[model samples]
Target: MLRRVRRQVADTLRVGAMTLYYLARGQRQRGAVLAQMFEVGNRSVVFTVLTLGFLGAIITLQAGFQALRIIGDTSLVGPQSLPLLVRQLGPTLTGLMVATRVGTGIAAEVGSMVVTEQVDALRMNNAPPVDYLIKPRFVACLVMIPALTVVGIASAFVAGMFTAQAAFHTQPAVYARFDVVKLSDLAEGLSKAVAFGAVIPIIAGASGLMARGGSAGVGEATTRAVVYSSLAVIVLDFVLGGLAFLVFA
Candidate 1:
């Protein structure tokens, strides 16, 4: 089991390196990156917004209630939570959502091509499958995930503001404080976003490329993509958060 895990890790890293090499060399399929960006960014906007918005509202409402019960004041709820949202919740939640939705799609698509022998065909034509298949997706994710994170953060803040006002009678001016936020907070969030974006496609593409045994293989690849991508997001979040603390605190 340990050997298998090591092999998988090595494979993932190899794919990631190749993808990065292609990206640095400016190799891409025409229109492929644009299509993937649409799939990753435009298609995901509504889902990210709704999920983060409701989560923000619930968090603020609960915090407000607890604050009122303990101190007869809910004024600090927004000020306290805003920094947490920007530094932790926003990027983390968006990464998990992308892992679940986009990771599965990437794995399944690539796995299908593998099973159907399309990848072999590409190799026969002297086209490196990683260059043709993974690079575009990598570029797309690298560019779009940060954008989605911004949209998600905005949505969550707006929802929290409304919740604070309606549930605790806190004024918008009081709840919308940005003085608590710092450059380190933004840096940490964007770093996580970029890291997650880079990792997801490589892991998913590696899993897909390893697919065998036809349909059953594709199913397993899809499952691995989602599970591994989500785990990567969480682990990266923890690592980046700790680094931010050590460096900035």
Candidate 2:
């Protein structure tokens, strides 16, 4: 058991070292990385925007109704509810969505490549597979996830505003309380995005790299990557949420 534990620890350290090394040297392949990032991030923009927009509309309408009943005035709902959606719910939901959507794709793609020996082909050509594969995805997801989060927040706000203004007849300025959205909230959202972005791709890509056996192994790795990455995002979200309260409270 001790020997097995030591081996596992050693393998983890080795993987960590390799991941760091590739990340450090990733800049050399900036063009490829940027291209991949654009493809991955941009491709997913439509879905992210649509999903967030719908969510925002739903939250706004529901919250507005509840607030109206409590205070006998609908306008109070706009101001009271926007902050909760933006500060608490928006970023967390956006990060998780991106993780599940794109992170799984990364893992499955890389895992398939490993199983098919495509990664070996790159290595045979003196191309480092990590540099060619992992770095671009890592950089892309990290950069794009935040952008996606921003889109989600904006969509949510716009949807909320539309629902409040059109459906409930709330005044425009009632929802325009920019003062409520503190810099601390923005920082927390950005921090969550960054942490999530860093985590998902690494977990997915690493799982793919570690895949053994044949097609079955690739499939298993792909599944594992998605599961592991999703769990990591959730755990990190909680940790960041707590930290956000401490830092911003």
The most accurate candidate by lDDT is 1
What total of clashing residue pairs does each candidate reach? 0, 0
Once fitted onto the true fold, the runs of candidate 1 whose alpha carbons sit more than 4 angstroms away are 25-27
Q: Across residues 1-249, which tens digit of lDDT does each residue of candidate 2 receive?
A: 677345434543565566679777644764877887886688778878888888888887887778778876776665666666666677777766776678667767877888888999998987787777877787788788888888888888888788788888877788767777778877777888788788777777777787788888887777767777777778887898898899778
- Across residues 1-249, which tens digit of lDDT does each residue of candidate 1 receive? 788667668889999988878777745577999999998898889999999999799889989989989999998998899999999999999999988888998999999999999999998986788999988888899999999999999999999999899888999999999999999999999999999999999999998998888999999999989988899999999999999999999
Best by TM-score, which number? 1
Per-model CA lDDT versus the true structure: 0.91, 0.75
TM-score (C-alpha) between model 2 and the true structure: 0.86
> Where is model 2 more than 4 Å wrong at Cα?
1-17, 25-27, 212-216
Count of clashes in candidate 1: 0
